[model samples]
Target: MLIFTNNLSENRNVFIIFLLLFYSCQGEAENKLLEVIKVKELKIKPEVLTIPNPPYVHLIESDSGQYLFYLNPNSKSLQFMNMEDGKVANEIILEYDGPNSMSRRSGIAGLENDKVWTTFRPHAIAYFNYKAEIQFKKDIPSGEVDITYVGSSFQKGLHQYGDKVFGMQPLFMNHHGMNKDDIQKHSLVYSYDMVSDQTKWYDVYYAKDYWDSGKKLSNFSWVRREDKLYIAPWYDHEIQVFDMQKEQVTIKVEAKSDHINSFYYVNEIPGTHEEGLLNILNNDLYGIILYDKYRDCFYRFFYPGFTDDEEYAIDKLWMLRNSRPFTGVMVLDKDLNIIGEHIFDKFQVHASSNVFVGEEGLYLSLNNENSPDYDEDHLRYMVVQFEVGE
Candidate 1:
């Protein structure tokens, strides 16, 4: 009887051990199910040599690997680099002090047809080739539906729908405050056909009550996902999504913040491909959110600045919010939940400056006040680097 009792006790102990092992393994598997992303720092040097300026880079397909074209529209020049050898291939000036003079503020677009196009303020569109040879120059018509005194907020231009290329024109004027003057100034959207080189303009709208309430047509804050364009009309609490093919405003997303100034589409890389992140910068402390379009989930990130959210002269600040300037490499995905945020709260960065993401890493150019090339009061650019995850 004693031996039988000892056997039963040993069996019960063995069963308890088995249960614990199974639960432990199950917990680990559940933890692994969550998405994980890491943000690291990278060191990258310009392949082509040039004075460290606000640079925009494009990867051109070459016979070998690829050639990265660093177009500095600010300086009106092109900096070409061979990606294979990590060396500067060539640097050519895109602008010339001809009989006509021009002032450009970073609207350079590299098309697939081996052409680079840029607009210099109120009225000039210039096109050049890989060799920096002038192909064509065009002027914006002085008479265009009578909305003059428009201070240019030249955002990105170049809308690509499948095989077709479309140029985007933003006729957005600046208004400091929500005043009566803002109601008079309207924002216009224009599409330039890349093949035929034809320009067409469209009037964007929000709610009728908002429009009648003295709200302005201000969609300079634009971003593209696939072929569709998402624009945030200043002063409106909603973001309107436009379908390029249908030529219609299809979707309107209600923003959590009152002032929806800017919106960025979080692109997919690896672990977080299923869910996308959308960043909307507003006047309040609630800045951005990770939005899962598929699952219909929202995750928010809150970081604030000391001063008002000012977009201008950002490339000029040495320390942002009294801290060392930092750059965001990639969005993070932690256990099916998206995390990780590096804010401009530390340093100011301009949306106009050239922002490039490559196989090497993410590169940013902030306006540096400490540089001797420009006076401390003047605007100068400083380049910085950040690493990405696989």
Candidate 2:
């Protein structure tokens, strides 16, 4: 009996040891899969420019790297700065009423052929030349017969392709008397032809799924690389890339994430605008996708969730400040295969702006004013540069 008892005890000890070894190996494999890339700081000349509320600053680097366009939406002005010394070359005041007036909220689309384009809410696209002169303004008509049902498109998703600009209308109309079926049938994407002065719609099926699932219309981003345009819905794990010439979705890439599938269903919430905002604030996985032409890769700036705690997630201010630390960036090759994933540390980068990939390296805005590393005198706008890793 004593020998039998001794053998049983020995077996139990061995099983416990096996479990520990297995778990330790599993942890190590996960760490190896997502190697944290290193960031190299490059200090721009101090006092070159003062950007108030740095988080709202939108930067567009000229193709020749000779100029930098700073779009300050808060100040309703666009400052053209010399890249060499950061001196203000020119300034264009974006106002509401005048010959040079544009929608104050109309965010910049991008720089193309020495011209900057900005999109006015609902249906206007304004173009400004390098000298800050308004070249022309185009109004895009919503093809919907029910003008009342027509919804606004997102400014960030606006892109100039060839002789036309491509943008997507909101999935659902927030106005009263709108039903689910009406919202689902709304046009997904629109292209305004500069030559014809006509708006055409493209058939994208997943866009219907967005309205059906009650996702917010503003939670989308666009990236154009050469002839291809990539559209990613912030709440969804998939990215659809359309061929500009064909005007059809040629490829669809789905990213793998454990937290993506854990989304809280919008169907459970009431269909009010307030409820929709609450749903997104509490449960959506927000992300932006950008194409890196220099490296021939795509980088996704993803925030899986605001917080694990349900109570803390409801606090708007707390959610905004802490969400950046939890943000993770995933790099994918041109083929859409994920190469690596890196979770940025607190104060390492800000999640407010889009990731800027330039010839120098990857750049991210920094706004942690409380950090010991923060320098107020020299740096009005802090930017961190990271070297891409294999």
Instruction: Please name the candidate that would achieve the greatest lDDT relative to the true structure.
Output: 2
Candidate 1 Cα deviation (angstroms), residue 101: 7.2
List per-prediction Cα lDDT, in the order shown. 0.41, 0.56
Please estimate how well model 1 matches the true structure, expressed as its whole-model Cα lDDT: 0.41
Q: lDDT (0-100) at residue 27 of candidate 2?
A: 41
Tens digits of per-residue lDDT, candidate 2, 1-390, equal: 001012445533553453355345444233113444333454444224454223223445665554455664445566655645656667766556777666443456666566776666555777788656788777667666332322222225567678887776544444234545565456557788888888887765354454455534435666777887777766677788878788888998876544454454544446664455454445646576767655566777766544445343234444354434456677665666555566666555655462466544356655443244555433233232222232
Question: What is the lDDT, from 0 to 100, of the residue 126 in candidate 2?
Answer: 74
lDDT of 1 at 155: 30
- Over 103-220, each residue of candidate 1 has an lDDT whose tens digit, in order, gives 4433565454666666555555566676666676655453244433222222345555753444444443433334443443343455546567666555554444554543233434
**Pairs of residues at least 3 apart in sequence or in different chains that clash in candidate 1:** 34-335, 35-336, 47-88, 48-88, 315-367, 320-346
Candidate 1, residue 90: lDDT? 65
Error of 1 at 305 (Å): 2.6
lDDT of 2: 0.56
Candidate 2, which ten residues in sequence have the lowest lDDT sum?
A: 1-10
RMSD of 1: 14.9
